[model samples]
Target: MAPAGPDHGGSGTPEPDTGTQRRLARRLVALQSAHEFAEEIVLWPAVLRHCPAGDALVTTALEQERQLKRTLEELAHISPGSQEFTQCVNTLAGLNRTHLTYEENQVWPRLQDGLTARDTVRLARQWSGARRRAPTRPHPRLAARPVVLGTVGLAVAVVDRTRDGLTAR
Candidate 1:
């Protein structure tokens, strides 16, 4: 299924219950929470013990998360058809891209150097437990690609319908 994003235009017709949207939202939240847990509970401690660079990386990631959360909250208020919603979605996507790049390029490698296999497993367990206890609302858009794509698909469908109405005039 297409990932959700602001760019997803809606159909002029009633919105169909695309299980994709809800699933994407849920997964996005789960992924973000898991990533955060891994860093805070597992990676940071290991990095502090072994890799000094981990400190800077974790700090940067946390700041980004804070900003992303704000943007997501704003986007949630604006309906998919609104310009504000699109802008927020775009911002979110950009943030996600940058964050993922940073993690994949710098943070993950540093974490590997700092953490042993046993540490990783222990951290993973902690993350799982945290996720189970985390609240359901306000799922963070952790990664931009999947969520944005899905949202964009829906947004585009909406836009197309609007355009069709104008053209039909």
Candidate 2:
């Protein structure tokens, strides 16, 4: 059967060369990077300074970003139709959902309370700058599912080490 048109279901007729899967993957990477940059550089600092018990949440979110970076790296090379690609996408979706929930429910409120509009705008601009300078190519290690998972594990280990250092003092 032919693919359904937009009028038949959602928006419009899908284009054959719209590169939907590639676009989605690129968007996911952009969003993840933006969120990580916002939390690490802007939101976390404000939360740590203004919100009570913000440090733990910031630390947890940072670790989550670190892990996600590794996962993305691993999944970077897999084509969308492959079994490994499907599994990697599923894993990324679950992790992203969880992270979004935590940020929306727990972190956002704290940031809203602490950060002014001006502060947010300034931070957003900084994030945009960082993203512009970020590498465009996918990490080489992400050529297969096993590598992706292994990279995520390594990132988690690094996060753990960082967390330990933070907690040590």
Give a tens-digit lDDT track for model 1, residues 118-139.
Answer: 8879867865664444322233
Q: Model 2, 1-169: lDDT tens per residue?
A: 6556764675674444335665677667646644454345445666777778888888777677667767776666667656687688898888888888988999889877877789879867865764443333223233222243245533543554465357541
Backbone clashes for every candidate come to 22, 3
lDDT value, residue 162 of candidate 2: 65
> Cα RMSD (Å) per model?
14.4, 11.8
- Could you estimate the TM-score for every candidate? 0.58, 0.60
Best by lDDT: 2
